[model samples]
Target: MDIRTLQEELVQYSKTIGIDKIGFASASPFIELKERLVRQQELGYQSGFEEPDLDKRTNPELVLPQAKSIIAIALAYPSKLKDAPRSTRSERRGIFCRASWGQDYHDVLRDRLRKLEAFLQERVPTCKVKSMVDTGELSDRAVAERAGIGWSGKNCAIITPEFGSYVYLGEMITDLPFIPDKPIEDNCGTCTKCIDACPTGALIQGGQLDSNKCIAFITQTKGFIADQYREKIGNRLYGCDTCQLVCPENKGKDFHFHEEMEPDPEVVKPVLKPLLSMSNREFKERFGSISGSWRGKKPIQRNAIIALAHYKDQSAIDELKKVLIEDPRPVMRGTAAWAIGKIDGESSQEILLNAKNKEKDQDVLNEIEKGLQLITR
Candidate 1:
């Protein structure tokens, strides 16, 4: 088989199947990435959502025996939402990051990779292929960078010259010995915009990120958010886009190429008050299609409460009081207590005083006390 010819054919096939950009890369062990991963782990900067085994993550041979090459693909998502809903004082809204605006990229990219795998198998029946999306053991960004898909940006995202940093990345490991493409040069020279725009200063120096302090990571946690970060999070429901939004390369780079990538304004930026009372089934039915719903409704609802507080939405005081009294989750109840104090309605102090006597959870009681203090102040 002419590996070079097959590589060219695969690139053409990728274009037909809606893959915006594709590149071939050697399937050798990711030595530099392994060192970086180890350093991130040592510094406790990892989001704890990554594949834990370092060896499995770095070595392609472990995932697919005799892996000779990797094929990386990038699909650009729309940066601008068309006719987005307005967030008024009476109807405050929280936003999901652009990455989560469309249908889950995992499913979209996996479908594309499956088609590519079938195409390869038809031509080379004996070839073995393994495909992965974001949650895979292999680092999609590292693979994309190695495949010349893009340069790793200062915000720790793959920044393609054509699509900027708004592209969704996926990769496939194969036994076919395709020639690799040269990596793109890093073009984020002396750019401090992403680092400066980070709400919690999560972006350290340039490329490094402290995931513990990242609003994107914090918004997904299913627990009480620390006081310092509550205000910093603003109206972000699922993920934070401050770093990406401020990138000069990403400026004016909005692509509505894929239909599935189009966002429903109401879904991505829903009213905060309605979200606080949404049932699990309702949450799943409305937001299940989007990637942000993967963490379930608890975290999103929790963030909604924080957003209401950030706005000091007095209109949501009634709903906040209901959640404080009836929500089964202690985290929700406690957060509502805190949000109530922040909102500081006409009767918020009395409501908190009443809940303070019946609340059994020590943490909830503490939050109630905090609420009481805020209302009195």
Candidate 2:
């Protein structure tokens, strides 16, 4: 089999299977990324969610011993929600980031990668291939960048001319030597929008992110949010899109190419008060299909509490009181206590004083005290 023809066939097949963009690159070691990863670790900027091994993360050969080339694919997702419901004072809502708007991209991209892998295997029976989405060891951005799918933007996202930064990336490493495409030039030359818009100053500079300071990362954390960032969280229930939303490249670049990527207005931007009382099973039934639920309901619920505080939604006082007094999780109770104080309802001080007495967890007690202080302030 001519490897060139096989590559061409794979590319065509990819289009037929709904791949938005496809590119090829040599499965060479990512030398530059290795140095960045080392520096990221030394600075403690890692999100703690990445593959810890630097060698495996930067070297495709380590991931697939027989690798000779990589096939990078991108699927564009909708950046804007259609007919979106507004969040009003009476019914304050929290938003999940655009990345979590639709069904989990992991499942969607993984399905596409498997089909591509099957197509490759059918042509070259002796070829070896390994496919990975976000969870894979090799960096998807690095692979996509080298393959000309897009240039790595200042926002730390792969910015394709067609899809902007609102694209989901996946890659497959193959043993066969497919011709590699040249990398796209960096187009974010003078754009400081994404860096300037980051609420937490996570974008330390162009293409570098301190995940600890990233609101996107902070929303996914299972523990209590830091005081400094808690108020900044706003109404975001999961992930943060300020950086991407502010990019000029993404202007009017909404894509509804994939039906699975369309968001259900109610699910992605749900009312805040209801989320505080959602049972684990109810949460699963409502949000299990989306990517944001991967961290489970706790983080989302925690953020919901903070969002209520951000809005100072007096209507949510009862919900916050219930969570403070009865929620088993200390993080939830603590967050609710803080929110009640921040909201400063007529009974807010009384509720926190009551919770402070019954709260055995020192953390929750501390939050209750803080809530009382907030009310006093």
lDDT of 2 by residue, 314-354 (tens): 99999888888888999999999999999999999888887
- Model 2 off-target regions past 4 Å? none
The numbered model that scores best in lDDT is 1
TM-score of each: 0.99, 0.99
Clashes of each: 0, 0
lDDT of 2 at 325: 82
Per-residue CA lDDT of candidate 1, range 308-336, in tens? Answer: 99999999999999999999999999999
Tell me how candidate 2 scores on lDDT.
Answer: 0.93
